[model samples]
Target: MPYENPAALRITSPGLCRDATFSSKHALHLLSWNIAGWSAKQKNLDLIAHLNKSDIIFVQEMWSTQNLTLDGFSITCLPATPSLPKSKGRPKGGLALLISTSTSARIKSLSSCNNIAMGVLLSYNTISFLLINVYIPPYSSRVLTDQAWEDLDRYITDLEAQSPRALLIIMGDFNARIGPNNDALFASNLWGGEVIDHYSSIYGRISKDSRINYGGICLTRLIGSRNLIMLNGLNQVDPCAEYTYISGQGSSVIDYALISQHLLKTILKFTVGNRQDSDHLPLTLSICLPERGRLTFAHNQMANPLHYTHKRTFWSPLVASNVALFLTSPSGLAIKEKITNATNPFSVLTDYDTLISKLKMSLMLPSPSHRAINRTGLPRWFDKDCLDVKRQLRQTYLHYRLQNANTLPPEYFIIKKKYKSMIVTKKRQAVHEGWKALIHASRTKNSKSFWELVSGSMRPSNLAPCHISSHT
Candidate 1:
């Protein structure tokens, strides 16, 4: 009646619905938000609204916040470390994990570092999970930059070592861009890219850096090798293409959710929530995990027909029926491209020439491959040469992300324009009709067909492998 505990509440709105899709498989909606220090009242109200929109929330930058509670809901907060000897006071922020009390996940072990790194080993029925909250220091520099990633990497490795057989969900303000680190330890520094490139570059160097080199043990390298989900934002539909830092000259995603391999197929949709509050926009994902146990989504012999059915049909846009039918599919890259581009402020005057330039530059490679560095006379301890390569790769990706973010035409502004010639919002009526069809399918048991429909919307190109965990 009175909103259970405002600090902890369970939302039962249709919008906040959850169900076990398969006998053992269930759907979990995980939401991450940087609330930007909302007032306790505002935080409570917002938590209600957010819970209405999501199943669980990972909140950050909630300093001086009021106690939160809600009916049928449970919350675990990693409070700011108390009384530090100046040198070790850590940061002032913390993270909170809110879950439905109706659900079975209970914290088995919980701990938080001063910088807001919290881990909770949770058990739901027979399934187990390790959920971690981390907020690495942003504003890149040489020493601190590498240290942050190393810390995160070590933390994850430690978790993995502890629970080798559990599902993992690591989320928060990573502060580090998926893009670059600025140090010269990386190849990008040798070639010239952003400081963030240093992360990859330094790790590369560490692999080969003869001194203090872990030799292929760097966190960035580990992320790539492990098959963890990186949630790419460069391409369309990676909702993160939009700028999260509203006021910065530079904008690329620093917030993310890295899930383990076991949950990859279960990822229903990864979306960026457009809420105004923190410098970082909220990231939302809907995952369909096994309710009872794992069930194969595809038959062993069905094979991937599309992998062999490769024809370059991406040039032609979707037909009216297809558009109507495919709009709701989670894999509709083109639909996202069309809708976001049409409604975005960046798409207006999107100079094709400029896009081409950015794309090319974004794809450029640094000299001396990671493999090459292993052979070169470069010091092995630091693998500084490999760092160079990492820097180059990150810079290339960052370049594209920045370009894409800038080209995004503001949605509100686009609707206001009355151009002399009709600006085709990609045949809006056709798309709307398609959306209707998608909605209908979603209501039935045929929603699985959505992927098949949307899969045809994008052309197949070899993008870099996403940072998913390599081993289960």
Candidate 2:
């Protein structure tokens, strides 16, 4: 059992830790949901059965007319073409990458024309992860313009100049709204929340100007070139006023996840999942590493056998005996018998004003806007215990996506060995069906030719009518 290197290999130790629990050698699990426009019938199959416990999924308004396939995932679309519409509304979809089926998650497509962004690389066992899924396009000031935030900062500076040393995890729905009115000189001030949601309506003064405008830019070049680590920031997601978007009221917190500061101290748990059919609410982060095995070297005696016998360490004690049975059981033995019968280690600051007047009911910790306004009074420190060894590496990504979807080879066998003569040229399929019927008659809504329903399962219906010989 030793021949690995297909590439998603990081097997813990690039910071973003995991393993708070579960670990068939830390699999992979990344599920970003914003499947709003795919319309919520049965809340979009219970959000794809909680994104079938994820391996990689980043969907956003994915309604490119729907050629569906979310169970056992593997779809990659980023539509909004026909010259990228949106002068009226209903036409801002793009960003779909749903990989799972046993790791090796790959979905390139970057040089953004309107921004749906992608970059995943899960690979199992030997380990690997490079995740980058964005869907930035909101907060308009004209067509939510400024060349749509410089085409989302040149598709996040060309996906951090193509995975600059991997281990990323960018996450999505960046409708852009960082905290404290977003710093960095008003993090692209999202056009002051689209001019406060367009003068608080009156038919939002007949909207349009690219839909009541706004702006957002300071991702500080992927948070200073992948230094990341912000995790569920904008008021720690859903702190409850639950409004991905509503009309008769207003809401904000534009989803996010950053993380990269070497996995921000192994980020044990960073929560936010209460997705009510998408305005955006599903941001789970749980990382824990430092736990492999095998190490025994005590014979250095000034090594000289051509120097290279062994020297690796640092990976034992991942919760030493469950932290010694939670500090010796019985509720840590009644808080270590009241801190050893109160004999100072700063004895709770001498009964801290009689233990805050007998503990002001469980020492208070609920305020993320009062648990976003009382979400079942959330507490116990947001009920943590989250882990994701790539979500126990989803049975090694459903046995490598059904052995590469049934013995691989057929995702259009190299696009029919390079567009099999522009698809058997009959005047280039009648000028590609007359420019796809004039981009489906300047949409507004009705898009669904997602590369002709997933390019006929990667094509090969007796191709060879090859044309294209205009070598003049």
Candidate 3:
């Protein structure tokens, strides 16, 4: 049974007090991950890195934690209900969605079934869409009960009844193993009035290694009935590496992102994350929107000319080298002769704004080409040693893979264990250092630095304020 408590769901608005407007240019990048019960003690730097690249994030298995606040994204989370005895020991079956602050997408409504599933109705401009995040627990019987299917069927039916035209995106850890192998069985049971064997043969069989769990059958029936398409089917970029969950037992593609049939063409890419922060890997979906615009940032803006001028000492040698090369070129020689032979020095001088401009022109370094100040600064704890350690870890992993084709050597495991320990140590040190800096700023009452630290810690949301309500 799903959680029945209405208070289990909480709507959070991070920074914005108004709604944001989105268009075609603002492509939506969605990331889904099962964090296995995220806690404050876990290092979120890698997770934050992924969040920075995404417009919206859907997370599952998020247990109750004190640090619910994430910088720039408004979070809506639904905890497991106490009413469900199944949620006893595994209180981590919570679901949450994080929407970028800058997006114009506004939450129109929210709905949840405790730890089973959560839904958010979002609107951009006049276009509305339903985003559902779900987590179906693994059944010991390897079969989905009739009630499970009924619950899903009713929830989706209600959504369709509420807004028939709204686009639908259903994503998260379904704990379902879906592929071509079980198409015949799924189609025969749920897809009636059609030639089951013919449809199954057309879909073809998935890789032999991919298993078909009972939940997968339920998902197939749901999508087939609704004319929905799974994003996994569109993943032609890398077919073999489609699994989303891996453990000591092995790997299986259980996580998914499904969309309405009409929105299939909008999908640009679907792939899984290589980094492992949890047992389940993250899945990403990039979709082109109907509107168009570049994603701009304050840090990406061009630096002031004065700032460059003050740092001339650093670039002087490189500039001189470039100028020397230019002087020997045909175009540079022609300009030099023209300047020397010109009747009026003032006229030649007028053609060039300043010495820096002339030098820049000669160096072929336009303002746009010059490197800008890094607006997105690194975390306070991220130091050179940490970076070096990460590089070494990658190198070691690469070497191990190259040496041991398909086999895992005992030595390889030892190397991996050693590096993992070193990484954990470094991460702890960095977090400690970051907290120390924050404490110092607060104690000193340095408002600017303190707020900057706060803002930097969590990217501020750029979206307008909107309300969220969860229907149990």
Q: Root-mean-square deviation of each candidate, in angstroms?
A: 26.3, 26.7, 16.0
Task: Point out where model 1 deviates above 4 Å.
Answer: 1-25, 38-47, 65-71, 81-91, 180-187, 190-219, 234-240, 248-250, 293-472
- Candidate 3: give its CA RMSD in angstroms: 16.0
Residue 56 lDDT in candidate 3: 79
lDDT tens readout by residue for model 1, 1-472: 1211221122222122244443313667788877665332242343455655666778777663233333333566665432356424333565676654334344444545546477767665566778887766553455665676666667777877888888888888765442332132233222234343223311110011111122212334545555564443412225334444433243455566677756644566666665433456678877665555322211112122221111122322333445444444553444356545675343422333223223322232222222112333322322443344434433543454556444433432232232101223324544565566667767775756555444433322213235777794
lDDT of 3 by residue, 194-298 (tens): 443322212222432345656766776676677565656332422433557655456577888778755655555676665545667788887666542322212
On the 0 to 100 scale, the lDDT of residue 236 in model 2 is: 26
Ranking by lDDT: 3, 1, 2
Could you say which candidate leads in TM-score? 3
lDDT of 3 at 277: 50
Each candidate's lDDT (Cα)?
0.48, 0.43, 0.58
Cα shift from native, residue 452, model 2 (Å): 16
Best by lDDT: 3
